[model samples]
Each structure stands twice: as C-alpha cells, then as structure tokens.
Target: MPGVAERLTIDHVGQRGDGVSLTNGASLFVPYTLAHEIVETERDDEHPERRRLLQIDTASPERIDPFCTYFTRCGGCAIQHWQPDPYQAWKRQIVIDTLAQAKITCPVDPIVDAHGAGRRRVTLHARRGSDGGLRVGFAASASHAIIAIDACPILDPALDGALDAARALAEVLKPVSKPLDIQVTAASNGLDIDVRGTGPLPTAIITALSRIAEAHKLARLTRHGELVLMRVPPVVTMGSAQVTLPPGSFLQATAAGEETLAALVLQLCKGAKNIADLFCGIGPFALRLATKSKVTALDSDGGAITSLQQAIKDTKGLKPIKAEMRDLFRRPLVPQELRDFDAVVFDPPRQGAQAQVERLAASKIPVVVAVSCNVQTFARDAKILIDGGYKLESVTPVDQFRHTPHIELVARFKR
Candidate 1:
C-alpha cells in the first residue's frame, strides 16, 4: 500500500481526542496528531483501518510525555499523552458539548480532583499464556488480545501486587483447568480475590494459590474482611455497625472515593428533613445521611437492600430509613412515589438515569443530585432535569479513573 505523501493538517480532536479528518470521503482517525498539526499518513485498505500517522511534520502545544512506559501498548488509558490542564479542559468541554447538543443551559462548574483518587474497586479480564509464562493485563484497545503489564500506576498500591501474583499462579495451574476470570479488590485490612469458573478448583491449584498468597504476604481474609471469596456473604463494618455483603454484591472500590461521594451527598441534602436515595448500594450515602434526617433507600439489587437493612438495624441514633428492592429501570419511582421526600439523590450506572431522571423531573423534586461516570450521559440527564424546571447549581468532576477518559461527575440542581 502506498503511503500518502502530502502533509495532512489535523482539523480537530474527536470524542476520544484522536485527530479526525476526511480523505476521499472516508473518515481517517490518526492518534497523537493534535489539532493544527501536520502529518504523513499510511492507509490500510484491507482492514478498513483509518489512516495512521507515520511522521509528524508539526506538533501541537497540548502534547506531553506519557508517564507510563506502556502508554501506547496498554489500552487502559487514551489521553495520558496530553498535558494535564488541557486534558481536563477537554473533558469539561465534552460535558458542555453534550449539554449544548441537547439544547440545555446550565453552569458547568470547574472539575474537582479527589485526594488519593484513581482507586478502582473491581477489574475484570481473561488470563493469557506467553512463552515465558502466564501473563495478565488489560485487553488491547478495540481488540481482544491481552497486553501484558508489569504494573498499573493508576490503581492503589496495595492492589498492584494482586495482578502480579494472579499471573504467577496461572502458570502453575493446568492449561485447561484453571478459571479464566479473576477479580481482585482492596479492603481495609488487605487484598481479596475471587476466581470464577465452571466448577471447583482442583486441590493442587488451590494449594498453589495458597502458597503464592503466603509468599506475597497477601492478606489472609476472614469472612468479615473477604466478601468475594466465600460461599456465604462477607461481613463489612461501617462505624459501629456490621453488614454482610453477598458474593457478587456491589461495594465502593476505595474508602476515599466512598467518603468523598458520601460527603457530597450530604452537602447536596443541605438539611432537608427527608431525602430519597435511588440505587443506594449498601447504603454508603443513605446510611451516612440517616444521621441528619429521614432517608428512603431504594435499589434493584436485593443483596444490597438486605445489607442496608442490616446496617440500619446495627447502628443506633440513625433516623428512620427504609430499604427496598425496586428495579428502577423497569419500574422507576413515579412522581407520586417521590411526593413525600424533599430531596433526591441518584448514583446510576454508566448508561445514566434516563428513566429515573424523567420520573424524578416530573415529580418536581426541590433538589436533585445526579452522580455519573459517563459525562455524555450525565449531560443528557442534566438536560432532562433542567427541562423539568430545575436549574443546574453546580457540577463537580471527580477524577476517579486517572490516566483515562473516564470521569465521575456530581451535578446539583434546585427547583
């Protein structure tokens, strides 16, 4: 295939920050080519691959050295090469663009950085075999091939060793016998591991894992400290109260992130006598809020609701709180259902709270706090709230996933 000889000028950055342009009516996406930069390109017609930048004729001021050695090969983060300030500004701009596309007017507050941020709770992937041994890492960008990594700088230090140890253990296990899926989480005490597969692990494999665990000084967890391992639920302590989380139950990944989110929820409540927390997983925010006022916690996850109920029972001096399992996606809280609450808070999934936002907006709730991981979805939902007569008060962007395009945002709106 012949490489294009002319120097191509980058017009602008796309959603993923790649330089986007058109060549003979075909879309070309060239990475590391910033807006206004000129570059030589190669086209792979067979793969339908976008034109790839072969040489840079000019560089953009926004570029910077990526901190990670594996930045290009590793698929976990896309924008690490960009300067920090411009990167953050671009993220905020995307949020603004989404709202603008929806024709919504609201103040986009400056992004907020959390202390000790970038702590991820759960990571999922498959194990790969290499000539040296077994290798574990994130899948390549837009591909299923595994990209081996020695260390991930973004994760909490404690959780770093878990991946290395897991890879080592995979080498010892029989090629066809071991579980393909592994999940690791960091707890207050130590690291926890969950291996999921078709059947029970062989005795030899378990012994090998145990030896690896002891050698690495990985925390030997108790039923209370390890929720992901045992057949029965794991017990978690909140203040003086103890709650049990069933296997596969959702919990906040980092103690810092949870505390930050909880504090924000309380601030948004702002002394409301009654508050409704939707999709309140394990009462992280709802339980904390119960100290100040009455709270109604609702979630579709039965295990989460059960844990929240147990928490309410164990803690004293908490205001009246109720936990219910309702699939908000299918049967969202109607306007009449929300009539009794003065304020509402929602922390929905990446898809954002489309159904819930519509229902909440129709309810005419005085205050609404919407937390989301996806900025585009958050902006869309914010528009819904604004259309319902609530004015956007503030937006705080939390960098929960550093070195990546992923952003966590908390938006407050008042009627």
Candidate 2:
C-alpha cells in the first residue's frame, strides 16, 4: 500500500538542491522544494527516504514559477523556481562550505553569471518507443525513460534547430534499433551534430544520414566521431585564433563560460612570461592566454592537440605555443620540466587532477591557477597545493550551467 499523506517542513536545500528534512533520525529528500516551506507529500514505501511532493502548503518567498514546463520532468535543471539573488548566493555558499570541510580558508568571490545567451552545446538521447516511434529528447528525472521535447529554453538561440536536426538524423538511424546519443554544438560556421551508439552502418544507411545532414544544413555530421558527412569544418572563435573543433571534442558548456574563465586565468597570470596549460582541451584558455604570454598547452586528446596546432598555424602574432598530446595522469610535468614556466594553469576534468596535483605539490611553480567543475575535487586539490607551500589567494565560482547544481570555479594560488 502507498504511504499515507503527511505534512513536512523542509529544513534546507541539500547540495544537490533537494529539500531535506530530518525524520526518525534519517533524511527525507523532496524535489522541487525550498527551505522553511511546509509541503504535503507521501513517502514511497519502497524508497522510504524519498517523497513525492503533492502540494506546497506554505510556499517560501523565494519560490517563483519555473520557466520551462519540463523543469521537474526533464531532470536538466534544478532550483529553477528560486529567486536569482538567493540562488546565486547558494551557489557561492556551496564552494564556501566545501572549502570549509577541507579546512581551506580563503576569499571566495561571488558566483559569476556565465550562463550567457544559454548553453551552446546540448546532448540529447534518442530512443525508440515500444510503439515503434522514435523519441528524441533528454532523459526523465532520475530515470532512463526519455521525455520527448521539441524545444529547450536553456539552449542558445544559435542551437534553435539542434533538436530538429537530431530528430531527423535519429529517424534515419531508427532502423538500426540502437539507442543513440546525439551531441549538438553551435559552431561559428553552423550546427555540428555527432551521433553516437550506432555501430557501423551499411553504405546505404550512411548515405541516408548524409542526405539528412544536408537537409538539415548541418556543418558536419559524425558517427562515433568518424566523419559521415561534411559541408564545412565546424569552427569556433577563441580569443584571436579560430579553432576548428574536432568531432565531439570537449568544449565549455556555454560560450560565455569559456570567456569568463579565460579572463580570470589571464588576470591571475598577468605578468607571466611563459605559462604551462595542463589538461588544455582545445586551447580554450591557452589560446587567449597566448595573446600576451607564451603558452605550452598539453592534453591527452590527440584530436584536440591537432586542432590546437592547426589553429596556431593559421593565426599569427602569438608568442609561441607548443601543443602536445600527453597523458598528464601518467606523466605530469616534473619540477625540472616545470621550472621554465613562470605561471601554471590547469583545467582538469571532474575527477580533478589528483595525479598531476600530486606532482604540482612537489614542484615550486610560482603562480598556479586551477579550474574545476567539481567542488569536492577542487577542495581536495586545493588542500594538496596548500600543503605544498602555496598561498591561497582567491577563488571565484562561475555559474555556466544555470538552473542546475553544477558549478565551475577558478582559483589563484601564489607562493
């Protein structure tokens, strides 16, 4: 039997933005809720810690109407109903609390609004329903089920046709019956679409996909990053150089996010003559940093390194850039190799740069700027740097994935 309805008061929002309450010494998590609000819900019998919010008996002043109809169902954005001022503060506080837990003390600046013009890239899932119809959209909240949608409000205006293009391409691949993951990016040339999960296709099917790409006016189309069709190279402008994005290459979620983060890194390394960029994906920061300083960019992705090398060749006036393909986790620059650089900037993945940070802790880099997407890992890495005689200067949180719990930050360290 379903649990009976009950009234609960939300104590506060958890780190994932769920409203939390203490009951019987255990935590109850309710979605789409806020602190100090009373809500009527029923606890799931199978999942006792979870509750389905039935109604808001007493709404908080911070609550506002969600912008998207699929806010709760799509699972893409959380805390959309909260007021902006408080929401921004909550994001900044997340960093503050995480650092405190790591016993790290420093000035954490306010969160930067980097969700400019909305997300420039989006990955949509394509699945076929039991009724034999194709469904293309994001996954439902907390489930693998797909929620079909035609438009997403959080996408940039440039990606207006991304969903449609994804649908058309998915339709051609429907006969294969394999679930697909389509990534669409708004490039300077045009929309770049990459279709994944479909194994090798017959030449006829490949031809069909190419025709669909042409019909949709896609700049390029790729299957598992192997070129399927190409009308023009997908290019993106970063600082003074124009980078041709490799198929499915890593890029900042929002265009403004890249600019904001690069600006902060450049400012921190103001007087740096030579800087080393570790985990440099496609040279988002290195390209910009090179405008005034020499840069050595390194990443594990050969495609990204090739793209960076190509971008530098086309653009002149850069001091010097040596883009290399090296696995930093296996071979972090030793102190001897790091001695030549005046400043070091590393923007690592969500796992953080544990291996590289360990090496960095052993080094004597003068100025180190760390860019990260996960707060927990950032704190861990920051602790390592602090243990290595680095002074924690300042930290700034950048909110590029707006309306979600995801946050990115840039931290400056000095000796």
Candidate 3:
C-alpha cells in the first residue's frame, strides 16, 4: 500500500487542515494539499484512510512557499502554505459551521489574529537514537520519530536559546536516556525550564542540572514542577498584576492572545459589580476584571490559586479577589452559588465545561461569557446553555497558535 501511488483531486480542507478526496465511497485524507488541487499520493502504511502526498500535479493559486524549513517534516504546524485571507476565512468558517451543525445560531465575528509575537513557550522531546546519540526537537509528522532541530521559527524571539537549552540538558541526562519532555517558558525574568518523564534523579545529577541552569541563565529549573532550583521566580504579567508562575503552569501561547481574549471578555461583562472567573489560571481574567469589579477566582489548581492570592496581596488599587481551589468538574457552582454574581466567565479545558455549564444554565446569571479552545465541545456546551433559556449573542474566534488547526473563541450569552 505504501508504494502504490494514486492520483486524486482535493475537494476541500477537512477540520484538521487535511485535504479530503472522496474515493470508492470512502474519504481519503491527504496532508499539505489545498482544495481544488490535483495531487499524486500513496496510501500510508500507518494509516489506511490517509494518503501521503508525493507530488502536486496542480497547485492552488492561493498556495505560497512555507517560511519554515521544517514545514512538512515537523508536526507542529498544519497549514503554513495557504494565503492569509483564505486561511482566516477558513478558521472563522470553522466556528460558523460547527455552530450550525449543533443547531445553535449566533453572530460569528471575523477571526482576530492574536499571533502577535509568536508562541512564548515550547515543549521539546528528547530521545536517544539507535546509535546512542541524543535527538532533541519535535516529533515528525504522524510518527513518534523526533526531528532534531536547532531552532523553531514559530517560537517567540524570547525563546531563542530554548532548543540549545533543551539539548544541553538532554546531554546531561543521556546516560539514563529515558525519553524526556522539556517544557520551556519565556518569562519576564528568564526561561523557566521543566523536565518531565524522568522518574527521579540522584543528587549528583541534580547538581549537574543546577549548574546547567546557571550556565543557561534560566530563572528556574523544575522536575515535573517540583523545584530543583530557583535562581529567580519566573513572573508573567497578567493585566495590571504580576504573577509568579509555578513550574509547568498553564499559560496562553501568546501574550497578545491573552489580551485579545480578555478584551472580548471584559467588553461583554462591562458594568457588572461582581464577576466569577471559573477555571481562572493565574488570574489572567480575574486580575484584570478586579480593576472594575469584585472578582471570585475558582480553579482546581492549588498552585495557580495560591499564585493568584499572592498576586492580589502584592498589587494595589484593585477590587477584592477571592481565590478558591475547587474542581469545577466535580463540584461546579450551582444556581444558588451563581446567584450572587452579576457576570460569570468560564474558560474550560478542551473537554469544555458540560457539567459546569449544566449548572450555569440553571442559574439566572445575567451575563455569561464562555471561552474555549475546542470548537466542537464549545458548540455542544452552547446548545446546553441555549436550551436553558440563555441567548447566544456573539462568538469571536481567536487565532493564537497560527498555522495549526487549534483555535480559541470567546462568546457572550444573555438571558
């Protein structure tokens, strides 16, 4: 099947940015192709329904040369060759189509490009090659094989030395050679490095890593978020507040993306005296909303809640923020608890907030803002909210992880 080549015409782009061609009553997914393009492809050995693009017989007029050398090799980006105009439209249409499929109607706004300064963080995988050599970079497309890279174009300029730092750390840990995932975050002070997948390290190895951190001028080094060493606390500015990030803390991919999503949230929740920030991570929305309204920040992450509480103590001239560590999935705020807040905001993980939304739907909270990264799940949750008598007003898509299928959206719901 791998060697058998076939010609196909791409009909359209699928949700994952792959070109789809109907064949023999089945769909064939081909990557790195555009709609209405003729291409020669071969059936992939790993995936039966997928084809590997071998040659482009006819290219689309919208196609452009990809900027990155690792365009097709690295799995990080999906579509970098398409023109911006069509690409943005395709992204916005994704939201519209997804919403329509769920039978929910709302005004979907134009996509906002929030990839201002590129991604501020990256996770590099490190594995030992068969020859006992270390490979540090992203995994190859559709495979577990690592594509060793010296630098990545999509990363922010602040993470200039992230690859080198990961490689250097991998070199030190090469003896055990257990696969390593090094997450590097560019913060206000310096790079915050977190190493995972290593069960444990001896003191000698820990000392070596500490020296490497010093040599790299990293703000801190952590093993699975347990601090190995902290030369300085890694701080991230969230609106007016300064938040010291815990190791492996969740952060919006781009600084501009956070601001963009927060702006939309604030615009919809304006004039509310009380606000509830659900799944509030490091107070990105909570801290900003506190400037104009009393904020109650809820999250399951104790580290995040503690950090938010600490930030409130250090900042000035802001409304009171009550930070609580509660798992919304297990115990979402019910209608009784939701009655006090004039506005409620929930930014859940990819699974969306079905359980939480069920409770929020039962409440009469005047203004509700939903932020999500997964469109399909968001649509399902929106349907639930609409069923509970809330009106879906506006949905604005945010593109922070450019060239990837992933997108974020902020929506407003009113009674």
Candidate 4:
C-alpha cells in the first residue's frame, strides 16, 4: 500500500549517503537528498524508515547535477550529487568517526581520488526486452528492472562499447530467459568477460560462444567460473610481474587504486626481511612486496595462488615469493606459523580478517599493514590488534569508487 505524500527537512546525511529526516519521532531516509534541505517524499510502508525523494522543496549547496545521465535510476553510483571537495572530506571523516567509535585514534591521510572515468569493469544485466530484443545495461536502483543504456559516462573509454558487446554476446547466448549477469573488464589486450545467470553450457552453446568471443575479440570468456573460450590468457600486471588473472579473479576497480595500495604497503613494510601477504589476490601486494622482502602469499583460492606463482616464475628481477592455498578463516596461521615473518600485510574482503587479525595480534610481528574496504570492520580489527599492544600509526583513505560512499583504507600498525 502507498502512503500519503509528505514533506520533511533533511536533518543530516546518513552513512549510506541517504539524507535523514526527523518526521515527528521516527527517522526517514531519502535518497539523493542533502543535509538541511527540505524535500518532498512519500513514506514507503514496506520500509517504514525509508522515504522516496519526490522533489527537492529546497536545494542544497553541495548538490550538483550528477555527471552520469543515469544518476538516481541506475544502481551504479551513489553520492554523485555531492561536490568533490566536500565529498572527500565527508568520506574521510567517516573513517575518523568509525575509528573513534572503536576508541582508536590516529592520523588519517586525506582521501585519494579515483582516476579518470570511474571503473574499468562493469557488470551489465541482460534480458529480453518487451519486444523480444536483447536489452543490455544496468539494473535500476533497488530494482530488478533493467535500464537499457545508450552510454555510461562512469565507465572507462575502452569500455564505452561494452553495452553493444554484451548485447551481441547475449544474442549468441540465446534461450536465456532470465537476465544474464555479464561482468566485463577492459584488460590490456581486450575485454575479459565472465557471464553468469545462464543455465548449464552444452556443446552447441559453447561452440557459438567461441564464435562470439572471436567476433568481439574477447580476451577470455567464462561461465560460472568455468572457461568457455580464451583467445589469449588474460594478464594483469601486479607491479612488475604480469599475473595471468584467473577468470573471475578479483582485481581492483582501477589501476591507480592498486598502485596506491601496493605503494603504501611497500612503504610501511620497508625494512622487514620477511612478510606474510594474507588474502593475497593474484599477488597485488605479494609480487610488489617481494621486490624488497621475502613474501609468502596465501589465499583460499588455489587458482589465485597458481597465478601468482606462475607470474613470479615467469617474471625476472623480483625477490622470492612463495604462494600457498590456505583458508585463513577456518585455520588462521598461528603465532608459531607466522613467527618467521617480521612484518605482515593482510588485505581482506568487506567482512575484514578477524580470524587472521586475532593471530596477528598475538604474534610478535614488528609491523602490520591492514588493507580493508570496510571502515567499520577495519576499526574492529584495529581494536583487536591495538588491544594486543600494537600501536595505530596512520590510515590512508583511498577513494577508488568515486561518487560512492564505499571507502577503502590502508592502515599501518606497529608496537
């Protein structure tokens, strides 16, 4: 059931970039709104706390015409309405606040800017249009409705033709009734595509997909992590070494972001003779850290370890890097296992590395570099390490995903 239209003055910006309004006693969240701006909204009964922003009764100084034409509708970006300088400050403050909540304090470096157009990789949703034509683009905000886009300003120039490429691929991938999730990355040579949401691949579909890969010059094509076709091995340069990126392997959204994270890791872990790189995806830090220190890279995924080992073997002029497949969460490297490494560098996913950090806190490692995508989880882990006598040195905030509230940080710790 739809609620009646109402008006409310947005009191503040919430963590997710939605504006908050104190309507009577309850809080209302309006998307694309700003602090202290009066906006018209309709309270959503399904989500009592959320309000759909109908129109701005009064605009804000921080509000600007979003750069992307698909601004509010497309789920790709959030906070595009914010001006750059203020946006940067606010995002940095988020890290500050998160650490403060955990009773930890340290110098936080200014937010690093996202380079060029937003991202090199984008996953477009493909569906059969109402007229039975291939519709390829992003899903709407909080919706499964596909928005067929002509252009996406936020994507890399190399991927400007991605929509058409996905559409062409979808044509070959006929009989896919449900929407296809196509993850396309603009690699060094050509597009790296990993398609999902399709049923099991038979011989006939695989043959056609091979032809599609050839026509589009796709560097590689994969389905459900299984290789369908590969014109050439997809390569990603991690520092000096070019690691063959296993299909669906995690890569940083931007090249500059990877360099920033790697540079910081190299700087902080400077003098240590041995370092453990945990959750090391394709040697983003291991390959680089091996330049100065002996690095042992470990990940749960064997393919990632294999790729890193292969790169180290094929590349020249790098110190020794040992790769291993180990699940750190289930059986974290104990203090005894980590005793050999003087310094530790761990970059975990959004959930952060609680299990690994617990062991790192107990270890006598002189230096630890924690790279995380979630500030709250990072703060939690930081507290664990600090409680174990590690001192929080400094945190560098990297804004790889521009115009979005998502934040990444590289924090250095020492006794």
Q: Evaluated with lDDT, which candidate comes out highest? A: 3
Per-model TM-score, in order, reads: 0.85, 0.98, 0.99, 0.96
Scored by lDDT, model 2 comes in at 0.93
Clashes of each: 0, 0, 0, 0
Candidate 3 least-lDDT 10 residues: 168-177
For model 2, residues 67-101, the per-residue Cα lDDT tens digits are 89888999888779999999999899999999999
Name the 10 consecutive residues with the lowest summed lDDT in model 4.
112-121
- Minimal lDDT window, size 10, model 1: 221-230
Candidate 1 collision pairs: none
Misplaced by over 4 Å in model 1 are: 2-7, 22-27, 44-49, 115-117, 122-124, 129-133, 177-179, 197-256
Model 4 TM-score is 0.96
**After best superposition, candidate 3 residue 267: deviation in angstroms?**
0.5
Ranking by lDDT: 3, 2, 4, 1
lDDT of 1 at 50: 59
Off by over 4 Å in 4: 1-3, 129-133
Candidate 1 lDDT by residue in tens digits, 210-296: 676666555442222232123233455554456665444566655566677777778888879899999888888888888888999
What tens digits encode model 3's per-residue C-alpha lDDT throughout 244-268? Answer: 9988999999989999999999999
Which residue pairs collide, candidate 4? none
